[model samples]
Target chain A: MDILLALVVAVLLVVGGLFALLAAIGIVRLPDVYTRMHAASKAGTVGSSLMLVAAGLHSGEFATFARAFAGVVFFILTAPVAAHLVAKAAHQAGYRLSRGAVCDDMRDKAKN
Target chain B: MPSAEEKRQRTGLVLPTGFAGLWLLLFCLWLIFNSSLALPILATGVVAATALAWIFTTRSTVWHYVRLTPRTLYHFLAYTGVFFVELVKANVNMLRYVYSPRIDIRPGIVKIRMRLRSPIGRLALANSIALTPGSLVMDVEDDALYVHWLDVRTTDIDEASEMIAGPFEKHLGRVFG
Candidate 1:
């Protein structure tokens, strides 16, 4: 049981770290604010949640697990809302899509 | 002077029915947070939960969304399963895009109509879309949602709605109804 628990924690931490790295690379590589927000919001939230879960599981105490669980729940609830708000604000502030962009329905609507 | 019926309608709760369930849920949350089973802690949990619930139900409009039917419970469990699977898929999709040397993405915004009538249900649907792979809801106007798609598969509104919001809507409908 001890070995199994350690293995689980190791795997979770490694996976979480990899995702966080990917998100960082994506922020630097992606073309615009909107796309970077994607990297920051989804990947970042999931990666952190995974790490928190791993920490909770590693401790093997109910209090630790409870705190970790609360963190996970809070992340899931708040991350997307924050992303939505940022996206809306950026759009309202008149940010343009990347050059490789193919379509713009909002622009078309505004024209009509 | 409003009639008793009018007052009940405004509050939107069936009273004692949902009250018990809400108390139980809040108490469980308290217990989990405290991580204690002592008699003193349990008594405090009960009191705290009850006081919180009573204050919210009486003073706020949140009572309208405090439903606790068995059907909603089942739907909630199922939604949890679906959400996790989609989250994994999203991460994998993003990983591929971030790793590839040659970036090829057809990013655009698309409008999709939602059928959910309840405020809580609509909010859930929007959040689910935002968290899922390759899609973020930029704005919501009436029944329509403006989504910033990482890859614009189609410009058609109906088709886009079916693609982006379809999976989440069914479970949310049942849960929020």
Candidate 2:
């Protein structure tokens, strides 16, 4: 059982690390600032949340698990708000999409 | 300096009625692990966690939105799991792309017409694309996504659009819509 637990924790950590690595790559490879921000938000929140869960498991104590889970909840709640702020700010600052792109509701909103 | 109900709410005794149960669990674990009287430690942990949750929830109207069903909850977990796997695969692919001796990066912007309506769903789609190895969500205007690819694998815009949107949009819709 202890070995099984260790294996689970290891898998979690590796997966979390992979998510973090992908987020960094996205920051570099993505086309626009807003898109990059999206990568950062989801990957950062979920990646760290996974890491925290693993830490809780490794500790094998109830308090640690509770605190870690609480932290994940906090992160999930905050990340989207931050992403919205970034996207809204970018739009307000006059970033344009590619020409072939179809449908733009924000532009319609601003037209009125 | 307050009525009973007000005081209870202020102390967070009204909601999280299972608060004490979680605290008791923590206390027992502390005693078992560290071999000590963990009442004080358990009290501290409960207070801190509750306060943190309260503070986080209070900052935005988003948190006050209606609760999610269990079906939605499972979808969310499954999506995140799939997302993690994609992230890892992307990272490995990115490394290979960056180190290739003869760089063949045909970078260009591609626009994808999207169908997701929920702000959360739209955001998830954009973020998921951005989280992939070579794609970025540069701009989103309503149902359209303007993406920047570090290396364009195809000149056909529709092909690129479908390639990027395939599983991500489907799963995000399930989770957020």
Candidate 3:
């Protein structure tokens, strides 16, 4: 049981860390604020939640699990809202899309 | 039938009907956080949970959204399953786009109409879209939501709405309705 539990924890931590690394690379490589926000929000939230779950499982205590669960819930609730607000602000502040970007329907609507 | 707005307006010292459930949930959380069942710990949990619940039930209009009927519960679970699957798919899609040497993406903003009537439901839909890969909700005007798509595949509003928001809408409608 101990060996299996440790293995699970190790796998989760490694996977979570890889996602976090990917998100970071994405932030550096993505073209614009919108795309970066996508990486940060999706990968960042999932990565952190996975890490929290790993921590909870590793601790093997109910209190730790509860706290970790609460953290996960809080992250899930807030990450998207934060991303939305940031994206809205970027758009409102008139951030330009990348050169290869195809269209801007919102800007077109605003003009009319 | 009392309108939600009217209920909000006519509130007094009387606790909201959801207070009991709220208190119980808070107490459970308290127990989990403390991981203790001693008399003092349990007593503290009850007191704290009660105080918090009293304040929450009195000041917030969120009680209406706290409905947990068995059907809604089932819908909620199903939505969660769908969300996780989409999350993984989104990440994989993004990984491919980000890692590819060509870096080809046809990003655009498209207007999609939302069918949800409840504010919470609409908010959930918007957030879900934002979280999903390849889509970010830029703004919501009236019944239409403006989403910034990483790859704009279709311009037709109906088709786009069905493609982008359709999967989550049915379950959210059931859960939030």
- Best-matching candidate per DockQ: 1
Worst 10 residues of 3 chain B by lDDT: B1-10
TM-score of only chain B in every candidate structure = 0.84, 0.62, 0.81
lDDT of 2 at A11: 97
lDDT of the structure predicted as candidate 3: 0.86
By TM-score, the candidates rank as: 1, 3, 2
lDDT of prediction 2: 0.64
Clash pairs, candidate 1, are none
Return the candidate ranking by DockQ, descending: 1, 3, 2
Off by over 4 Å in 2: A1-57, A69-112, B1-67, B99-104
In model 2, pairs of residues that clash are A35-B137
Candidate 2 per-residue lDDT over residues B14-81, each given as its tens digit: 54323343345445444444444568866666676566555544443333322356876677777787
Candidate lDDT values, in order: 0.86, 0.64, 0.86
Identify the candidate with maximal TM-score.
Answer: 1
Estimate the TM-score for candidate 2: 0.51
| Alpha carbon deviation, residue B134, candidate 1 (Å) | 0.5
Q: Candidate 1 lDDT, tens digit per residue, A10-94?
A: 9999999998998899999999988888888899998999999999999999799888988898898899999889988998889
TM-score of each: 0.90, 0.51, 0.88
TM-score of chain A of 1: 0.94
User: What lDDT is reached at residue A98 by model 1?
Assistant: 96
Better of 1 and 3 by DockQ: 1
lDDT of 1 by residue, B88-170 (tens): 98889899898999877989989999998877788888888888989998988888999999988899999999999998889
